[model samples]
Target: MAWDDKRVETWVGIMLRTGVMIAAAIVLIGGVLYLSGRGPSPRNNYRHFQGEPAQYTSLSGVVHNVNLHEPRSLIMLGLLILIATPVARVGMCIAGFLLERDRMYVVVSTAVLVILLYSLFFHK
Candidate 1:
């Protein structure tokens, strides 16, 4: 059982495909729930710009809302998962490089991961 480049690539491909599929499924379910629950005559207030609720703005808040089985929060969760897929792929690459003792790639992957995290969380 050797951890070769081909093996890593295969796993990465599987991970990406699985992540996207799961995220899409979650979003679809959430959308169905939302549409079913919303009775006829839905609110279509478009004059004023409205933002997401405070609970959905933060990760903790989104998780809390999801715990309560909120449809919007579930959709948010799906989106979050979708966004995280690439980040996780980068992390997996880092690990794969580390296992192969590839210093150059490990450093490059780490830098990329740091930049990604910064843009995702720290950018103003």
Candidate 2:
């Protein structure tokens, strides 16, 4: 019933492990789908060096493609989840610090969380 440091650490660890495992599973499934759809000898135009499509660059686009069962989009979504894991960890720490009445840590964690969000969403 207590929100102690050990308990918080344990939960954070669980969250990180679960996040990575889920991301890996999604990426693995996407890779399998990609390979299966590509056939035995898919094209490899290395010399051309075509970049990633615009659809995979934005969150909405990725979601749209994911809804359509696009393999690359699924991989992108997995990567996005992987990236979000640490941000979620920071958020959890903020909550833990708040519960512990640790003002200094709460302020520091909040700053870190804000910076992370700014960089992730607004730093263009």
Candidate 3:
């Protein structure tokens, strides 16, 4: 379609509508990983730096713990990050739609926002 066409803004609507849906999927999967005890350090997180590479930090203090090296868990974590990638795209889409002065995208963003909020609240 022509770039100058007014309906071009619909592309923005489509992007915003799709992005948050993907984010919802990501957090859901992340919740599953958390439930399954997938993190490398349950009580703390691993920190790599100049001083101590094996040190982990959490609510407690510095400790030593092996990270989760399980392939399945790693894959799940990757999937979770993948699921979260579209959030910025949604904002970009909203900006594009607003720049084009499109009202359709406003409605789309509203619906997407509701779904996004619902997914956040009800996610596993």
Whole-model lDDT, candidate 3? 0.50
lDDT of 2: 0.88
Q: Give the TM-score of candidate 1.
A: 0.87
lDDT tens digits, residue span 1-124, model 1: 9788999999999999999999999999998988888879768688888977798877677766785256878899999999999999999999999999999999999999999999888788
User: Each model's TM-score, in the order given?
Assistant: 0.87, 0.88, 0.37
Best model per lDDT = 1
Tell me the spans in candidate 1 whose CA falls farther than 4 Å from its real position: 43-48
Q: Output the number of the TM-score-best candidate.
A: 2
Instruction: Between candidates 1 and 3, name the one with more favorable TM-score.
Output: 1
- Residue 30 of model 1: what lDDT? 92
- Please provide, for model 2 over 1-124, each residue's C-alpha lDDT reduced to its tens digit, 9 standing for 90 to 100: 9788988989999999999999999999998998888888967778876777888877677767784356878889999999999999999999999888999999999999999999887788
In order, candidate lDDTs are 0.89, 0.88, 0.50
Candidate 3 structure quality by residue, lDDT tens digits, 1-124:
4343345446655665665566456446545656576445555445744543223222111212222533333334344444444544555556666666777985797677667656745655
Model 3 / residue 23 / CA error / Å: 13
